[model samples]
Target: MGEVIRVAVVGKGGSGKSTVAGTLSRLVARQGRKTLALDSDPMPGLALSLGLGHITEPMLTAAVEKDLNGRWQLKKGIGGARAVSQFSIEGPDGVRFLQFGKADELGLGTMFASVSGFGQVVHRIAEDGVLSDWSIIGDLSAGTRQTAYDWAPYADTYLVVVEPTWKSVLTGRRIVRLAEQRGAEHIHLIANKIESNGDLDVIEERMDLAARCVISRDPMVTTADAAGVALIDHAPESSAVASIASLAEGLEGD
Candidate 1:
């Protein structure tokens, strides 16, 4: 409703959730909208997929911790204001990026704790209105259990990426239900790694979701991943890129 359109990607593990988030961020940027791709997943894949590399030094991790602990003061316009601005990064595409370093299972009891910190960070970002003029795309972890409770409440739109496989479709359904329970306004499904139009149709039939876009398997995507470059930067003309762009347009329209 405000300036920024917050979006989150959810699905099962290995369902290309990060890939969709990265591509969607680029797509939003290409349309001249300032966008921030928030890597909330502890085992982040967004940075690598977007060719930003592994960023160990997150800008606001400690501040996020303070906020989660309720020790960070939220004065009228001082501490919270400074923290949000200092916590973001500007990527080559002019899109702001942030990551919560990979989760340490042994040290951290559960991924939920890490996500609680992430939720505070996202809340501060949203409340401060620093990214008000931009679109915030959260690359959430696979499965709703790890991130739904913390991140789903912040999303205006939920995009669930799923493959045509039975497991992926079932996962998509579960994520949809989770998002709905979390009060997400708009929920859409994208069928990635699609082999053919028939695959798209099959996904639509199998899952009780609104099919918004379908990206066929692209060899360039694999090559880009191998080279550690963002797919939009490495293969701008790829069919997958075009499909992602169209998906962004559809979101903007909605």
Candidate 2:
């Protein structure tokens, strides 16, 4: 009887994708909407940024297992995405956090498990919209792991974080097209780490994609990073916080 907007934040490595995902989830929660920040990245950076650490329950990826035929499949532990509460770690405001399995080294098992978890998310949400009233913002793994895993449908919309770099924009472009091909209803860009109007112009000039929001470069962001505190709590009035907070108003509109 409610609405849930699934947003996946993705982009190139070091493009601040996790930052946007963390901040955006908090902003949405501030509006009185319950938010679930799913950290699908094997690196799992979203938790600390949201001023959190540790998950109380089993990982969403933990549900997948290898069958007798060596085929990986989902068992039933994390089924019914509606009951995510038992599995998620609560965060600031109304935000909650969940992560895929943390990897000790890069390999196929971790990636495959995470991707299959995403499939379960999409299928359950599509069938019954079971996760109503919660905004799911997933911080996806960097680069094309999302595309390689074909996980675009996990999100109703994706916010591709773009920074002022050729590689960043190039990867953003690829993600936009790839998500669209996989039937993502919306894939919008969010320009991050913008230090100057000139930096914004650099993204505007070369990329055909328009930014839905621009998070300005602010020293407060760096300060919070070093201090290991939440930016919204540490520096509520910082430019980066303000800019991202503004994005909450139009989040589910599209």
Candidate 3:
């Protein structure tokens, strides 16, 4: 086995992509696999969903960029090697959380310059012989352009999350095409908020994507979000959590 399996969850906004990504991180970590969930959404939804409210710092990619461009040095003694360690927060389930802070006008130039360096860091993290030996799961923004430009190079598998709606399905197709163009190895689909099995069939037929799993709508998930807790921790027995666990298992198989 390699050091880590890098997975990126991407979909249209409001398609429950971050929820699934957060749940998948917890589920994978619970299986004794060290996991690092990177919130690349820029909106900071994953942190709230994962119950990590105290993480005020930005992710290593953005922070390091800020440092390199002379904006601000986040860590005092940390360099590239200690980059991941500095930004990642230890979760109760042993999953490390890294959230990319919102980009501002001044931060964008530094971010672009830091892209290559960030790629190197991600490669080192994903390659064998690391101490942490954790899988990297990223919750990226909804669009295909951002997924391709910002995340695809680092991800081994791109999990295209979609709902039963027409807009979501179309976005899934666009994501699949963009991921393929970006040289992603495997692209998987996980339909969320499904009301019925027929919806899954329709999505598969319409999008012609391999539906790995379908996560049903759960009121417990809503309640957990309202209460500001991770769905996996708040409602482990919920159908949505179970479905995310199944998705994690499938990714492990791959």
Candidate 4:
């Protein structure tokens, strides 16, 4: 592993972006690096994928407060590094987790404080310089909203995970265009859930870009998802996990 890995996993809903984000974080941590897994989705998916399993409370809720202007902001003295140490939940392989509060029946209104706080922390970490050695893998909300909003300032690379579906391809295309607009140094289309030999080709042709990595459509992945278990824990030897591991290796070398 050479340079630190800072990437955001983005894609259409159900394209397995969370799986890639969580698995990649753990893989990088296993290599003796401090990895931070960020889940920006209000309805989180990374917690389960990271094997933390259904974190009921928002991790950053305590790290934010309403200032005199009545807006949410990170509390004084809680910078990025301290936020990670105090607020981030530890997962398997020493991967640290942070997420926006989950939206319940009341919706995102109840979680605005945590959302604002998390956003501040993300921005702070990118500029902090102290956490430069940390590997950051953020799983942005599915689709292009996060990319358009620049939620991942820390990512030099954007891993746009695309499945072999027309809808997914279009979403990935939009994200790629957005990332490019944001001046991302490296934007790679990761072909996920490939079932047949031509699956990768379909995605590449539709997107008009070569996939940097291809993950097979392993049945074990579906099973694990249904059971709400992490793919690496449920099927460590599965081909999909192996592909993700290889993806981690390639990113580490870069």
* Best candidate, lDDT: 4
What TM-score does candidate 1 get on C-alpha atoms?
0.85
Give the runs in model 1 whose Cα sits over 4 Å from its true position: 1-4, 64-81, 104-116, 126-130
lDDT of each: 0.73, 0.74, 0.73, 0.90
- How does each model score on TM-score? 0.85, 0.85, 0.82, 0.96
Candidate 3 lDDT tens digits, 1-254: 32357789899988888888888887777778877787766565787667675355534654443445665443355443466676567886788876555555227755554443444455555453353566878888877767657553457788898889999999999998988887788899888888888989888988897688888878988898788788877888999988887777778767
**Higher-TM-score candidate of 1 and 4:** 4
Of the pair 3 and 4, which is ahead by TM-score?
4
Q: What is candidate 1's CA lDDT for residue 59?
A: 44
Q: Candidate 2: misplaced stretches above 4 Å?
A: 1-3, 54-58, 61-66, 76-78, 105-123
Clashing pairs in 2: none
Model 2 CA RMSD to the hidden true structure, in angstroms: 3.1
Show pairs that collide, candidate 1: 42-102
The list of candidate 3 runs beyond 4 A from truth reads 1-3, 59-80, 103-132
State which candidate has the highest TM-score. 4
Q: Would you list the clashing residue pairs of candidate 3?
A: none
In candidate 1, what are the lDDT values of residues 1-254, reduced to their tens digit? 22356888888888888878898887777667877788877675898777687666644544433345555333334343364466667776778787654665324423443444456667766565555576878888888774556564457888889998999988888888877777778888888899888888889998876588888999998888788778888998999889988887778766
lDDT of 2 at 168: 94
- For model 4 the TM-score comes to 0.96
Candidate 2's TM-score reads 0.85
